[model samples]
Target: MKRKRTISLNSSSITTRSKTRAAAAAAAAKFYLPDDCWESVFKFVINDKSKFKNRRYLNSLSLVSKQFLSITNSLNLSLTIYNGSRPFLRRLFQRFTNLTSLDLTWYDRDLNKLLCQISRFPLNLTTLTSLTCSRVDSLRSGDMCLIADCFPNLQLLDLSYCSYVSEEGILQVLRRCCKLRHLNLANCSKIELHGMNFEVPNLEVLNLSRTSVDDETLYMISQSCRGLLQLLLRSCYVTERGVNYVIENCTQLREINLRGCCKVHASFVASMLLSRPSLREIIVPSLRHFSVTEREFFKRHICLVY
Candidate 1:
């Protein structure tokens, strides 16, 4: 006859055997707290602006019980994908089932494969990254469709320092991800002035800083992105005519950053003040010859001239 494993119900086992008792407690759920209640407590702990860090609190909670571990795992919605995280990608995704935003700036592996792995989960990606993606493989035009298909609700996309993101890929993104609002194409060297005729009707904030964007590109942007609120063209090749065109056409433009566009003159500030009365902020390359009225104007409006 096959022998069956038996549990020791002795006094010694009851006092000293932690594993058996812990397992029994978890299985029994004697004082089972509701998941939602635990979630609320966790949120309060995490959102506390006090001196104690939330990570330490969570680490302590995770060790309390299996239920606590599962609840903590579910609370994790954002993850930073790096080269070291590649091997444990499957396990990580399984643990953090409700992940949304992902930062891949530190990722140096195959971008396509990583994206494919991410696509398996329906994550609502909408956020930023401190570091730029210069090390990873360039996201191709074909991959844009895959990205849009997976994360169609993506509102904010930070592709800064991704120099090889072609204009066609951009067009693909605009075509598919219609809900896209904030697009960070900063330092994308391959973005040329010509053949970018697509419109961004839903786009609100655009960062084209340190790119090869010229007058024609600005003109195109002026017509296409009329609903645009903020335009960052810092260190771009845009001229006076281009800037003026944008100021005229982009009616709702609240802020414009021309801090490094050497082609734009200081005199254009006066023109901007006269033309766009609704302008809240204007980051100009240089400012001079400010009258008392102009100083008052600067005070009234938050204009930053550098």
Candidate 2:
């Protein structure tokens, strides 16, 4: 037997290599699941409860895995697109279906695509409550109607400095939004006294400072909105008649701003404030002197900061 065993170098080397290969295979087989099983391993990553830390983190996570990207992109809620972010806004509307609130303010007269995109919002018009439109000069009548029609449940509407909006556009909103309670039209140069005619039954607060409205509009408002509690009319064309109209009719009025209303007589305003104890704040340009009866009521809650 010993004489028959002839040791060959090639055969010996082959036997050694086989043992090493077997050991490596055994180690790899100890731990590892199939690809299908691995998918179910990270199921929590796709849940909507988990939110991205910040925008940078969101961008980074979107690149991590397909499941993460799908969930993150589907959960976008509030979106704000500034002047240069129009492209982002367009693409966002196309994909982001869960948008609840949107705020857009542009620097230039460029809202062609932005306005068009807003018309396609998926949610019911009655669900939206907040809106802020600024500096879209070419906005037409139809555009205003489209907006008012969409947000039938709008509670707060701020159209500050929207120069294109006329009486027609505003009337569309007043007619539709019965739930509207707060409205701000400061610096809206095109808005005249005629535009002030709105029947906001639930309206408790209003800001019409720096508009073209005069005492005639104020009188009309008192006759219409008896529930109006607070009104701001600084720097508009007003006189004693306007102030008198408000105090006589709008007894619920708690605060008013008459700053820079040079046409009004300070003495009359001082008298009205004393007569109406409900008047809490009266902002006037100047109050040189007051009658004894006026001083007693005026000093109650008058803040003459102007």
Candidate 3:
């Protein structure tokens, strides 16, 4: 009777072990992410389609299975065509659909036709949130307007070092992208404020450092972009009034950079700092120390600068 009992226990233990292994295998087979999910991850990782930094990894993914290859080849990814990439832009652009962002900062001044082709993406009559394109002289105002009209969801536009982009391009972007939050026009020498009216209610950060902005344009931007929080106007022509408007009206402003803006008066800068009690720091040409009284004034009186 003892031998029979021991044998029965052993048999039950073996049965339990086998059942657990089988259940685990079944769960893995049923609950794993489908092939389509993997494709989405791949698309998000490679925002720039023209040249992926990890070519070896992408190639390995392509070899995983036919299903993956199908998705990879499908038009459901964001694309970028860097200037020196081997494949043509046409072939690269033909593969992607549902693209939400694009970075085309790798062009050699031939963007007219390419801009037209890019305008055919998922966004229609809307602006893109992030556009890092190189401006071209050949691009007419109409072409620029068309490009701006394409990305309705544009929030951050980086036209840095694009010499071809003028005031018209800036205006076009500002007019179309009402929700623009960050505008980087660094080294865009042609952006002037004369006769320019922009309404960017959601603009929080604007970097026009080293650009050709006079006092009038700077003041205009101050009035239009009331929600501005941080502004960089280094080496630009900014007077006392322009500084006053920004410091007084943009109550949420934390940092105001006037490095190389030689026209700004010291008195105006002091007042700006005092008005915005919440201002943590100001990037001036020579910022060595702050007096106790100045600090106290800022802490006490700057709660209502706007």
Clashes of each: 0, 0, 13
Off by over 4 Å in 1: 1-33, 48-57, 120-137, 287-291, 301-306
Q: Is candidate 2 or candidate 3 better by TM-score?
A: 3
Q: Give all TM-scores, in the order shown.
A: 0.78, 0.66, 0.71
User: Compared with the true structure, what per-residue lDDT tens digits does model 2 show for residues 41-126?
Assistant: 43344444433344444566668777556555655555567777765655676555555556655535445455666567564444
Tens-place lDDT per residue, model 1, 84-168, is 9987877887777776566777877677877787677554333211213443456777666667766776777788888677788
Residue 44 of model 3: what lDDT? 81
Q: Of models 1 and 3, which has the larger TM-score?
A: 1
* Whole-model lDDT values for every prediction: 0.75, 0.68, 0.69
> Candidate 2, which segments miss by more than 4 Å at Cα?
1-78, 83-101, 107-113, 195-198, 287-296, 299-306
Model 1 pairs whose backbones collide:
none
User: lDDT by residue for model 3 over 1-306, one digit each (tens)?
Assistant: 999999999999999999999999999889877767876788687666455554445666778887666666653334566656423555554444444567776566456766766666443424235666655445456766866667767787777777767677678778887777988877777777565565678989889888888778777877788788888888888787778777777778877778778887544556676566667667764444556765566556543221
User: Between candidates 1 and 2, which one is better according to TM-score?
Assistant: 1
By lDDT, the candidates rank as: 1, 3, 2
